[model samples]
Target chain A: MTDYSPLLLSLKVAGISTFFVFIFGVFFAHLFSRKKFFGKSIIESLFMLPLVLPPTVVGFGLLILFGKNGFIGSWLLNWFDFQVVFTWIGAVIASIVVSFPLMYQSAAAAFESLDARMENAARTMGASNWRVFWTISFRLAWPGLLAGLVLSFARGLGEFGATLMLAGYIPGKTDTIPMAIYFAVESGQMEKATFWVVIIVALGFSTIMWLNWWSRRNIERYKNDNA
Target chain B: MLEVQIKKKLPHFLVDINLTVEDEILVLVGPSGSGKTTILNAIAGLDHPDDGRITLNGNIFFCDNEKPLPTQQRNIGYLFQDYALFPHMTVEKNIAYGVKKMNAIEAEKRIERLVNTLGINHLLSKYPHQISGGEKQRVALARALATEPSLLLLDEPLSALDSRTRLECQEELQRLHATWKTPFIIVTHDMQEAEKLGDKIIFLESGLITKTVDNRSGKMIC
Candidate 1:
């Protein structure tokens, strides 16, 4: 008998986490790319921390922050009797924290490459700041932004360490594909573990293939439109 | 009338200029780094003058004591040296961009008139990267004029075109000016272009006007 709860849970967690990551990632990317102020480098570096930190390190940090007696954990326990630790919400948070930098880096690079003169031309022609961003900057940066979207979604889908630390393995509740695979192997259920490994590899491969096809199609459409 | 009296410090020298133009072309001719584009940028509110006042037809654009009017509200049409056409947009879309305040019918009518006037009717559907340099220049000009700005500034408007296209575009520019009759301030390094297009030419060096030539009267005014 095959259980599909882990697959469904993994997709739900990644989908939710990617949604939040996209909004914050693009927003912060634009802010960091366009504006300059105090402590900008430090703040940007902090955002990039999860990318370089070992998975266990990230998981350990999340544990410290969300563990009972921790600041947010204690407050949540006292207020709503709701604990994020060992729950689906914890998995979403962990995925977001781990996958954020991928989106941020791609979006920032996209924005940084935009020609300032084109933006200035829009401004002199009486386009508002908001209009310029939407019509010009965002449109021009779409390709790179789309790449970030795929990378972050994939990262979120594969998130394991932080999820394991925060959202423990519980069948039909917190058991995601990665958690299921790990436990199945530890318990000598090689067939189940192999099944999950194959599924994850196929998912990752298809995601990347879709991104490439989408990018090429977009470029072709752009050229055809111009022609 | 466009009035400019501004001072700004540059890396090499201080740019100090006081000039005015009314329904005529005023050309700033100088060496590469003599702050010609800087003056145009200041007038367009793209860059600030460290100290001074700029008024277009009596509306204040910038003053030391008052907050500078943002570029969006300045109603100044600037044709950049590189044309600065939006690559992703078609020629017609680029021209129509600055005229969003008008209803679709009126905006379409305006765009039609501009493309016809600039002879870019054939290239309306083409994007910036797909057009020739001359076509790009004409499209950019149409865009600048789309808003019916009270003042027009050109920064090396013909520098990128070949000699043949440059000559043709220069004549087209004069014809457009005659029809529009707004204040025109053009920056150029070519003395011949200054003579051809300018009613008043100011020769600048190290950020100061070294000489002034009234091209209409052919009189030297130092």
Candidate 2:
């Protein structure tokens, strides 16, 4: 009987995936909202597709696209020596894919709530695009983006069917807490599984509470701003 | 030195503009929807004109027939009607934002001078949301001046204030203008404001310049 490595591995995977989601989410959201481009609405819909689709479907799609013999999978394996199937990294990719819509929408809406004049003012002050994004756009949208980050991270935590499909049931390698709980229930280890479930419940509850508190404080600050 | 000629169309208005302002205050007075702000947006590089050129100090800020220089290089400062300060930053960071070339020490000195002169020193650490509207105006002015802009564009600078505060701001604007010596382009629809503060007035109606007045002369009445 292998120990609890899968649980820890899942946490690691979820954390990494959330980081990438937040970084790229904010960037692309800013791009989508601020700068108009070709096929903008289509790009937006594509980003949002995972949000409405079944997690299993998304996992299956990711599998067909990134599995070793698949189109992008073979290219990456040849060029970057990266194989994305049945790994902890695979679990993260699935989580990020599912949760990115939440992040992007929140961040984009936050960016939009801001006055465009601030960016214009920054430009006239000789601040470059990088400067305006960091000093003006990013700073102004901080609270909204933070709320998005927390939502995505929590979304990653609850991920089950997607993680099970994409990362598989490799004990101590890719079996995450959700998959472990499922296996425990199926195999009649109800008591042990309940202990792990409690831990996750506590973590989820506390994380959500903190997120709520942080967002409330941020909202207050924003209100004070518009006051 | 600045020269501008531009034609741009919006949903309900067609903005065709030509203007020049030297080292002096140029007040723009117009009815609502007359394209006064559009002209300011054109000059600020926030809005692109459909055609023509904008030049400043012998350099092209924007020329439709040629490559365009970015707004940051234009050396102008704009005050928003609502004082669109970055809500998160304290008064100091807001001012420091535009003062990129100023060394930290020089920036500090200038920030102090601004706060002292504008009478907002006590509110330096306060957020924009925490300050009174009048204080916010001074803070905005300080932020605009922090960059040492070649020209200052004040968009209804005192319009958001109460009557008493508006008068105070009008006086403060004149005082700051005298000290800074940079060109000021004040935009407002209030004819009284134009009469009080403008050295020269450009009256815009429907995005077109209709009348130009020498406000400093005793010959003009609102």
Candidate 3:
């Protein structure tokens, strides 16, 4: 009997991580896109570190931060009796850390592309800053933001090294699709590994196709609207 | 009365001007980069002047020493060169955006009146992207007028329209101005448009007002 728990768990981790990633990504993008301050580049570089660092390095860093005896982990354990290490929650964290840069970069690009005049027009018409952001800025940049969301979700789904170091490989509890595939190939179960690989490839392809379709539809709609 | 005395240092030159206007169309006629739009932006509080004061009807809109009221509270209507309509919103929503302080029924009534006056009633449910250039201009004008501001600033209002559409919009603007009874400052490079619409035309050259022509008698005042 083939267990499909790994695939389900991987989807769950990716979905939850993407939610947090989307919020932070858009918020930081909105913040950084409009202002220039001291240490702006430094702050931006720190958020982008995970994308450049090797997966093993990122995983090891997370392990040190969230281990039971570690700073945050120890506080949580003592006060709330809640543990994150070697659990599915740890997997979600790892996924978020690994995938956040993709979301942030794309969102920032989208925000930067917006016309400053449009926002200024809203303000001159007596719309507050908050209302202008929601009504004008976010609405215009939705296409690029949605694309970033999909990319981050894909990145989270494929997370391997961070998940291994933080969540570990516990079947039906923490083992994700990538981890299952790794263990299957290591034990010479090529057929089992192949099955998971096929599933992942199919999912990735469908996402790309969907993204292309969405972009094409938007272009056609724009043409029709303007015509 | 609107009183403006401001000095802004641009990269190319210094923009220093002092002017007063009443309920008349005051046109800033100049070439591109002559600081015409800059004056409009400064009045709307979209751009800050290095040091100056702007007062409208005894209310101080901006004073360099004091914290200027933000753009949202300035109660100025600004029509951008491209109209700058919110592309995602319907024509009605865009017109009603600034009237958030009004009750829903009052807002709806205002929107209905403006839409009918602007002849955009049929386009109320359509997004900006779905409208033609003339329709977009009408919608933008309605949006700017919906809030009942004391002052109106327009930057190159007819520059984006084709010849035929521009003539129609120009007539529409003149008709609206007759009833609105607010001080208007319009920036334009087209001399004909300036002569036709302006009661007092300020000719700017190199960021300074070289001449002020009173078009009321079809003669140059300077």
Total clashing pairs for each candidate = 0, 1, 0
Ordered by lDDT, highest first, the candidates read: 1, 3, 2
Q: Residue by residue across A1-227, what tens digits does model 3's lDDT show?
A: 98889889989999999999999999999999999999999999999999999988998988888888888888889999988988999999999999999999999999998889889989998888998899889988888899999999999999999889999998889989999999999999999999999999998999999998997887676554434
Ten contiguous residues with the weakest lDDT in model 1 chain A: A218-227
Query: Whose DockQ is greatest here?
Result: 2
DockQ of each: 0.58, 0.83, 0.71
Model 3 steric clash total? 0
* TM-scores, each model vs. reference: 0.94, 0.94, 0.95
Q: Is candidate 1 or candidate 3 better by DockQ?
A: 3
TM-score (chain A only) for the predictions, listed in order? 0.93, 0.93, 0.95
How well docked is model 2, in DockQ terms?
0.83
Between prediction 1 and prediction 2, which has the larger lDDT?
1
The lowest-lDDT stretch of 10 consecutive residues in candidate 2 chain B is: B213-222
| Model 3 chain B poorest 10 in a row by lDDT | B99-108
The B-chain TM-score of model 2 reads 0.94
C-alpha lDDT values of all predictions: 0.91, 0.86, 0.90
Q: Is the docking of candidate 1 incorrect, acceptable, medium or high quality?
A: medium
Error of 1 at A143 (Å): 0.9
Model 1: runs farther than 4 Å from truth?
Answer: A213-227
